[model samples]
Target chain A: MIARTCILFILPLLLAGNANAHHSYAAEFDRDAPMTIEGVVTEVWFKSPHVRYYLTVTDEDGNKVTWDTRGLTPVKLVRQGWMKDTIKVGDRIKIFGHVGRTNKTIMSILDVTLADGSVLTSRSVAYDIKN
Target chain B: MRLILVALLTFSFGVHAHADESEFSGMWMLDVKIPAEPLAGLLEIEMTDDGWIAWVEGGPAPVTIEGNHIEILVDARDRQGFLFQRKLVGILENGRIDGTLTSIDVVESAAEFGEDGSSWSAEAFVKEPPSQPVQDISELSGTWVPLRGVDFRKWTMALTPAAKEWHAGYDARMDEPQKRCISPGLYSAVTWSFPFEIVAANGKVVMLYEAFNLSRRVFTDGRDDPDFFPNSSMGYSTGQLINGEFVIETTLVTQTVRDFNGEPISENASMTERYRLSDDGQRLSVVLTLDDPDNYERAPIRRRVWTRQDDAVIYPFECDPDSFFRQLFNEGRMQEYIDRTPIRP
Candidate 1:
């Protein structure tokens, strides 16, 4: 019965930090650690293995800490309707995902909320077969 | 009765013998269903300038023929890569050679010798040069999307105590070779969510995986074993058509951990896959069997089903080690990761 389950529904299981395809994904990011940050995007490196963004988040201490936020690869993200210029370098956005286990700046992006209130998901399209 | 040992041939796809009953030379296709699963093999005995040289599965073997009595001694490595002697003394009658093959390994001599040894028969098969087949494998050959649901992506591996300890100490950041851009072997290659294309032609099946931009060749022609095969992650694979499905057996793979959980598949680990197509030719299903006697109590079976996606494009998914190292350096843990590694090559 477990074999018949829709494959992409296992993203939640990944959120649990159990079955991962990436190398040491659990070692890089904790399953239980969740963080939401709102910041101004400074750079976006669309590349293989992962697409990362350099965001300057103003902490509560009023200091600027540039966070290297990681997301899905350009291949998987493209299938989920994410484009290269979707989040511009100057655009302000809110990212909700699990924070890194050791590095607080790194994040395995779950979803991103753009300045115009449009939400882009980096999750697998397995949930919807049509997508 | 002194039963002299004979050849140890492991022939599935390719590697066939052109049996010549007269001189007892050339190739012989041996079928021994006794001590093992349909033990399909090949024996090549060729005459040199003066003496005769024999080989079993590309390894040197000994063959002696006199009157109707013949004895063969082949140093065959078992599935575990352990050396063993299998003796076959057969009487060549008509064109078929009938005999009894017995495992001379000391570990299981009692059980094998007590019984009438597994019956084995070999017939002279035509050894032709490898040629392209004129068969239709289009049902299994196409660009398809992998619907890999390893229990819907949850892993519950039954590991041995030795492997359990190895997994408990698994630090993926430093332990996994994929971090260095090496292929993670066939486990993740088939289990991942990327699209892969299967092309069958010219007596071979080529699997182009989009995950690591890796291409694996499965030879169906009766070619010799890859003597100089590279010791890569996926290893050497041979395929045969069983019934209407494609059966692939892979061994000599240079992989330790099997998956995300870091469960070990030891040096003796071998994987077998049977790919079948739905009646409607839309769905391609495969049952993967992993056997590592030292790592787990039992072999694990996983199913990967796919639907034909004609227009699916396979992009380059090469993992860059520089990018990974750069990311680690950005995280300020590059040194820590280096220190944690066990100096693996």
Candidate 2:
């Protein structure tokens, strides 16, 4: 049933990714320790593998730190009411997700919340076909 | 099959069948398919007097080829650079060649062999030389756009009934990552980069996909399949020439989702693609055949021509999945989309 549901609407990239075409998250991102960092939006990347948003947050000792949060694709985010400017540069935010599996890159965002009391989950969100 | 195996042994054993003896000594491309799939970037293989040489953009190594048999130090390093290490034991008589690759080293193999052997092989032949070296078109290189839906835009021809049925499910996709710009494997990225370059030489075709800048290599040498083949997103492709068209046969693709719509391609499908260039070499026609023993009974799936769009270049499509999904969930409408969507069988 799930297959049929998505067959007609399956995007090329989704179909391709579903094909498991290349590489692996386990091969690229750390899976053991999942970290959640709260910061301010510095930049946002809505592209493949996953979406990324830069959050500039201060550590517990008040030192400013930037955490790169990676989240789901825009197709999934559309259901969450995310637009091009959902989270812009200089916006206070909190991000949560696992660390990069390869190359020890910055923290990959899993989810984020804006200073305007808005929270968004980046993992996987269903869409409303009707609306 | 046994006779072919014997030929493989002869070739690998360094018996020196011919003065021009070389594992990959010709040009290759995708020819035909139960359902046609395109021959990626460029497929070329050249064996010089010194050694067998291969070139393609995007793969691990652009220049690599070794002696007749498995030369430990020579092969080991080349294997790592080649992205796959394989051995084919077969007989080589005159210009005739037949054999199978017996080992594959891609990480995807773990799932196919289960720590054992793989059941995959490739067989190819040399073809007449091209009238002239294929000229490179600089303007004709870059990423284009998704063809409406995967099944909507036709290339040079139309899809076979089976392929049509295979694509019929695209309408049900949930507009997930694609609308958001996720790397759609290596092939989808190809179409997106219309006018992309296809480097063909020797016995291989390298598809320089400009989307996420990923490249796919389709081998055309007369090498056989490996003993242990693995399941992957793109599966494994071995190429050859039929007439002037390059035919590539791809198999062992792992089941993958096309988009958030839950559209899926079964692992059992084997695809064949034919690439033909029109006179003057302006237009490139590619026909794809999708044959899935598990999904279809008869008739291969088909897709038509992909017109060469010149002015296409590499431009980044900013796709952020997190914010996109988050905003949707916040509206409390995420469940509604899922409920209305019908599930695939």
Candidate 3:
């Protein structure tokens, strides 16, 4: 019985690891810890691996720090009706998303608000959502 | 057809005196004893007073030839409508061809790459020749359905533990970009399409992909991969006719995974494919052998067959998704989704 129980337990862990081997955001973000920030879009560097947009957030002490926020590709953005000129540097934008694992400059945006007061949400539901 | 002929007549072209069609024309089969890696299917050469017209059963549309010039059209569908274009150029006996393939009536995406991004361009050449054209081979041209995914469907690629770990890291975020409708980069696109196109000319052969306007130039021109080459998704390939088969050997790939997909094709890998057309020009067969030091434990050769389909036209593949979420996030809406909703257990 103990052997069977251990087998059942270890097998699931092995399977889960295999499942996670393909690709996941787990290594970069913690699901348990969630945070949101509103900052200005300071710089945008659109290259491969992924496109990144830098944000400048000033602490209460008035010190300015830069954060690199990740975004989708130009092709994906274009389909979402985004033109090359959609977002620009120095734009006063508010972003909402998870703080990367490092808690440094990396953030994955879930939604955004443009300087003109327009809104676009990037949140998605689980592929199989109940309720 | 008349319009095409007129265009051919007006186009500036040249060829060697022995390069005439009579000696090279007529459908020919590959004699298998040539000792080439990947052999080509039945070979057909049709020469007219003006030019030549040829096709490998399952390859791209019949190539139109005029004097020394050759032309093929590549079209795909995108947000901008049915993207169609023509690539017109000339073929030479010494294995050199200069040409420009242009997008006909397509809208350029609003994106710009500083002052450098421009339209696509490339230079091509003939790679090899067979020992002798064989007769009585009629089972080699047509659309082949690969039972597996594009990359590893045939060859078994064994990844190192470190390589496997890197794959996990990439896949996690790779899909995030793919969900946004990005190009998925180049690697993902090639393997995305299960069955690719194969075309055979006199001493040369071509592989046209339905994936990302990606085409592999195999020179049956009797040369080897150069000592130095630019890094590219598809490695440099040198081809030639061993018997009557067109065999191509490729090496020096960039070794970058197209995306998070677990394919580990190495830069040092050498791949060879053989093509042959069956009689009647309705069947195509391809035999691929992959030799990679980094990814595979042992070399393996795989085979795939395609049937002729008159209606298989290459279409534009444009991958795009929405960007409003990122824009909104930029404007500060990150907390709304994460906090309002609970993570499903």
Point to the candidate with the largest DockQ.
1
Interface RMSD, all candidates in order, equals 19.9, 19.6, 24.4
| Sliding window of 10 residues with minimal summed lDDT for model 2 chain A | A1-10
Off by over 4 Å in 2: A1-131, B1-183, B186-195, B257-263, B298-300, B304-312, B315-320, B328-345
lDDT tens digits by residue: candidate 2, B173-289: 233334334445533543332234466566666666544545677876768898888876567888776666667788877664332222344677677776655565555555565
DockQ of each: 0.09, 0.03, 0.07
Best by TM-score: 1
Identify the runs in model 3 with alpha carbons over 4 angstroms from their true place. A1-131, B1-156, B172-203, B224-227, B242-245, B258-261, B278-280, B300-303, B321-345
Poorest 10 consecutive residues by lDDT, candidate 2 chain B: B72-81
- Given candidate 3, what's the lDDT at residue B115? 14
Q: Tell the DockQ for candidate 1.
A: 0.09
All-Cα superposition RMSD per candidate: 18.7, 21.5, 22.9
Question: Candidate 3's residue-wise lDDT over B45-134, tens digit each?
Answer: 455443454332211223544444444332222211112222333343443333443434332331111111112222221334433343
Error of 3 at A123 (Å): 25
> What is the lDDT ranking, best to worst?
1, 3, 2
Please give the range of 10 consecutive residues that has the lowest summed lDDT in model 1 chain B.
B106-115
Off by over 4 Å in 1: A1-23, A127-131, B1-136, B148-154, B343-345
For candidate 1, write residues B236-315 as lDDT tens digits. 78898766777888887775676555667665788898777766777776767788778776566555677888677776
